[model samples]
Target: MKFKITHVTTYLFDSEVFLEPHYLRFRPCQTSYVDVSDFITTIHPQPVGHKIVQDEDNNVVEFCWFEGMTTQLTIRAESVLQTKSYNPFNFLIYPQSFNTLPFQYNDLQKKLLFSALEQLPISKGLIDYALSILKRSNFNTISYLTNLIKHLHDDFSVEYRAEGAPFMPEETFQLKRGSCRDLSWMLIGILRQQGIAARFASGYYYFDMIAPAYELHAWVDVYLPGTGWFDLDPSHGIFTGNTHFPLASSAHYQHTMPVSGGIRGSANSKLNTQLIIKKL
Candidate 1:
């Protein structure tokens, strides 16, 4: 499948205010299954300095700094991509003992998965929620992870909040509804509680029904000893494959923000965004 994507974001301020350096994480990292045929970006109020660099997580990002004041800032990017079908369950788990619940990672795996495995305090409700799913999966590692996303999808109301950090895991679980990021964060929490390493992923999901109108999507990426990093989209109740195009990822959700910066003055601002994904 092939896709063309355009994303535009604009901030209108009541008064001109100096713009600080901004970071943009809009470039998709090419993988074995996905190819970027072309990509370009345009920024209004051209910056005095601009450079592109790769972050620790291998995300190609743009850093821009401006010289003059402006009342509006707009960033637009377009990309052409071609993707191949991916089999999410094509791998085998090494070390048979690690295929069940309550299993431990080897020494090196633990060191590499340090941050991905870290978790805040877990409430009983969240634990019980995960345990209930495990009972149905009979504690099988692969089955448990797959079942978790389906339960979250069937049990929660997926809504759109346009902006804000995701709610804490406990909060989302209790509320029973949240945006894509909230669902991703909640899944991260549950994975950590079960001794699995998971991270936050932000990207675009190509759903035919939502064509020509869409929003950035968020999902979870968990690491298994043998299967490696795998994407599970709780919002969609399925494992991700060719339909998912990941732009950037981080153990923390804030780091995966598509656009982030600060303002120099106290000007009231309004934001508007436009996104369109089309099949060619």
Candidate 2:
């Protein structure tokens, strides 16, 4: 499928600020599953300086600095692309050996991995609740993953909310709810805990049912042996495919914010966001 996406984020403040420096991770690269046919970005009042570079994890980054007093800031990004069908089971096996990387398995990673596994129906977490459904004897990783995705879709609700929430994996599992960013964080915590190198991806998604608009989105990717990193969307209940394009990725969301800066004055501020998407 092909789609055109428009994302607008605006921040309004009550008092002028001396300077603002921001990092943008809002551009997607053409990859095996998706193609970036056209793209553009516009920042209001212009910027003093900006540079595009690649980070340690290889994600694209755009850094910018704004000088002088300012009370409002706006950032807009648009894109056109095509996405492919997604199948999580197909990515169960890592294609290459990621063990050679500098990444090392630590105690925190192990604890998180074990915790995620235990929470699942197959593991020791909530076996009784899962047993009610497992008695049917029709279960596999593919099925389990699929069911888990759907379960999240049905049981949880998505909200724009704020970005101030502390990254807590245990709380999310207990609440069984959060925005895409929260879910992605939880998944990343689990993957990292398991000795799997995972990262948080922030981007835009075009969904037919949810108001044809592109909005800030988040997902998680797990490093497989041979295939590299495979994308997963617990909020969507499936693996992401070509339809998903990443702007920036990092070990956590705090590292890949689309726009971040400091305001000088103590002014009450409000933020508004709008996203529009359409099939091409």
Candidate 3:
């Protein structure tokens, strides 16, 4: 499948701001599953200085500085590409090494992970839950992984919201709902606790939107010893094949945010944002 993506993010302030330094991880990367055929980014009130570099995790990072007094800023990214499709249920699951990886837990993520498992009422940690699920199945790893993916999809409701919105994994579990980011983070944390290497991914999804707009999105990719990384979107109830494009990934949410910055004058002033996404 081929898709065209347009993403525009604007920042508005109540008072004039002299300078703004920003870090952006909005550029999609070419990987085994997806290809970035064409892409471009434009900023309004043109930046005075800018530099692009690859981060330690190999994610493209763009740093920009603006001069002069400005109250509004906009950054736009557009792209065209083709994607591959894969069965959401068919994936590799390594159950034997569920207790060996070093698990460094994040405060928010740890809370969410344990909370989600607690809601399962399984009386077991994440690894035990995965093992129990696997033990009941006689299928191969692919089938087992697929079944787990499907279980999450059928069990939860999809919830979409803007970035910076506060949410707890336990809350989502109680409601039986969550956004892609929430689901991905909770799942990754649980998998990691079980000795699985899973990472959080941030990017855009190209498709007809029910809301008539596009937005930043999140998902997860878990590593299998022999098959490598496989993408999963528990919120969408879909297994990402070649269609899901990746922009950046990190062990936790703070690292995967598309943009992070601070304005000097904003201590007392309010900051507002407008984001627009479209398929070209």
Candidate 4:
């Protein structure tokens, strides 16, 4: 499938203000399954400087600095993408690892997955909650992971907040309701608690029912012993594949913000965004 994506964000301020260098993570990283082409970013109030660089996570980052004061700032990103049917389960079990969960990684793997395995302080409450879903004595690793995902999907209702930071894992667990980012973060914590190397992922979700439409979506990427990273979306209770296009995956969610910057002004501001993803 081929897709054309356009995302426009406009900020209206009551008074003119200087803008800081803005970081845009709108460009998708080229992968075996997805090819990105004809990408462009246009900024209103013309930026004085613009440069593109790759972050540590390999995401394409666009940096722009505005020189003059302006009352309105608009940023537009457009791209054409062609995606193939990437079977989530296509890879072989390299080095005879990743046949299942509870597997160990070699030295190279340890270095790469070091940060991902760093565990957070887990409360007894969380462990109890997790065990409630475990149920079976002979728990297969894959089955446990799958059940964990399905449990979150079926047990919680999503409360979509268009803006703001994600809720903490504890908050999401107690409330059982959160936005996509919140759920993804909580899932990462859960995976890490179980010694699974996981990270937060943000991207675009394309659905046929909403053709020509798109959404900023979040999910989790867990490291499979020999197969590398695989994406799993707790909100959808499925492995992300053809329908999901990842923009960034990092240990922190803030790292993948689509557009973020600071403006020096006391005036009130309003934001508006437009997104459209069309099949081509």
Candidate 5:
């Protein structure tokens, strides 16, 4: 299937402000089951200089710089892409040890996935919450993840607050509901607590409905020894496949933001975002 997408982000400053260097991460990579046929972005008050480069996290990003002051900044991106259907479970976990709770990664794997495995302090209740799932899954790695996401999907409600950083994982777990990002982060915290390596992913999700609308979506990636980084969507209670197009992923959600930069002056700003995706 082919998809055409248009996404616009506008920042309206109440007062003139000097623009700073910014980075855009709207380019979804060409993967084994996905192809990027065409992609382009237009920026208003055209940037003075820009180049696409891979960041430390290895995300394909557009680094841009600007000149002069402006009251409004706009970025419009359009793209056409093709995605193929494939089974999300067409992989295997390696190192038999990793197939169970308290997974033990090989030395090299642990060294490389250090950040992804790091666990921030979570509330005791949340920790116990994850433990309950671990118990329910009988300590099986794959079953645990499947059960975790399913519980979140069936128990939690969805919210559409299109802006702001994701809620703290502990908060999301306590609240029992949140935006897609929040649920993903909540899953990340739970996995990390169980010694599983997980990270954040952001992109678009194609809904299986008539004339579906889409916004930026967030999910999680769990690293299994032989299978590499495995995709999991707690918000949707499934592993990802063709319908999920990931733009960028990082150990931290903030790093996956489509736009990253700052203004030079104290100009209060209002942010507005619009996204449209269609089957082509």
Candidate 6:
């Protein structure tokens, strides 16, 4: 399937402000199952200089520098891409040791996935919550993960918030209601606490013949020795495949933001975003 995507972000300030260098991570990437073409980004109050570079996590980043003061800023990004359908379950066999809970990683794998395995403080209730859906005695890695995804999908009510930082994992767990980002973060923390290597992913997702739902999405990738990285979306209760186009994957959600920069001004700003994705 081929698609064209348009995303626009605008910031209106109360007063003129000097814009600083900004980094954008919104560009689509070419993957084995996805091909990107005809990508473009337009910025208002034209920037003085710009460059494209790949970041540490391999995300394509566009850096732009501005020249003068402006009361408004707008960034528009457009892209065309083709995605090939594939089975989400086409994962390589995982290492035998990682097939069960309380699993241990080999030395080399441990060193490589250290950050993903870092322990974060989570409540006992959270641990119990994760355990409730698992079959401890007859544990299977794939089954456990699928069950967890289904549990979240079936139990949590989806709440769409137009603006705000995501709720902390603990808060989301306690409330059992959250936005997509909140759920992704909660899943990451839970998997990390369980000694599994999981990271946050941000990107675009669309189903065939579906109406164009325009917004950024969040999901996760778990690192299993043989499987490499397995993408999962608890928000949709499905394994991520051709429909998911990842722009960035990181150990934290903040690092996956599409735009990051600042303005020098005492004035407050209002943000507006618009997105359109259509099949071609």
**What tens digits encode model 2's per-residue C-alpha lDDT throughout 211-261?**
453567888766544455667787887788666777777665677777766
Off-target runs (Cα >4 Å) in candidate 3 are 84-132, 138-140, 165-168, 208-212, 267-280
- What is residue 195's positional error in candidate 6, in angstroms? 0.7
TM-scores for every predicted model? 0.96, 0.76, 0.77, 0.91, 0.97, 0.95
| Model 6 alpha-carbon drift over 4 Å, by segment | 208-211
Report the C-alpha lDDT of model 3 over 1-280, residue by residue, as the tens digit. 6677777777776787865688887788887556778888898778889899887666788889988887877778777876665454454434444222333344554554442223221224444645665655543455455566676678878777765632445455556677888777666655554545677788876666587665677888766543556677776666775556788886656677777777767534443444454444
Q: Ten-residue segment with the worst summed lDDT in candidate 1? A: 205-214
Candidate 4 residue lDDT tens string, 193-257 = 87778988888888877345456889998887556788889998888888688888887788888
Q: Which residue ranges in model 1 land beyond 4 Å of their true spot?
A: 210-212
Candidate RMSDs in Å, in order, are 1.3, 5.9, 6.2, 2.1, 1.2, 1.7
lDDT of 5 by residue, 1-280 (tens): 9998899999999999999899999998778889999999999979999899999899999999999999999999998999887887888777787788886777887899999999977899888877888899999988888898888898888787778899998888778889999999888988888778899999999887676667899999998888888799988889998978899999999889999999999989999888888888
| lDDT tens per residue, model 1, 1-280 | 8888999989999998999999998887798789999998899989889999887777899999998899999999899999988899998887888798878998898998898899956699999999999999999998998899999999999999998899998899889999999989999998898888999999999887833568999999988877888899999899998879899988888889998898899899999999888888
Clash tally, candidates in order: 0, 12, 2, 0, 0, 0
Which scores better on lDDT, 4 or 5? 5
lDDT of 6 by residue, 92-202 (tens): 666677777869888988988887787767789988888776664367788889989888888888777767666878999889899888888888888898889998898
Off by over 4 Å in 5: none
How many pairs in model 3 have backbone atoms within 3 A of each other, for residues 3 or more apart or on separate chains, i.e. clashes? 2
**lDDT, candidate 4, residue 197?**
87
lDDT of each: 0.90, 0.65, 0.65, 0.82, 0.89, 0.85
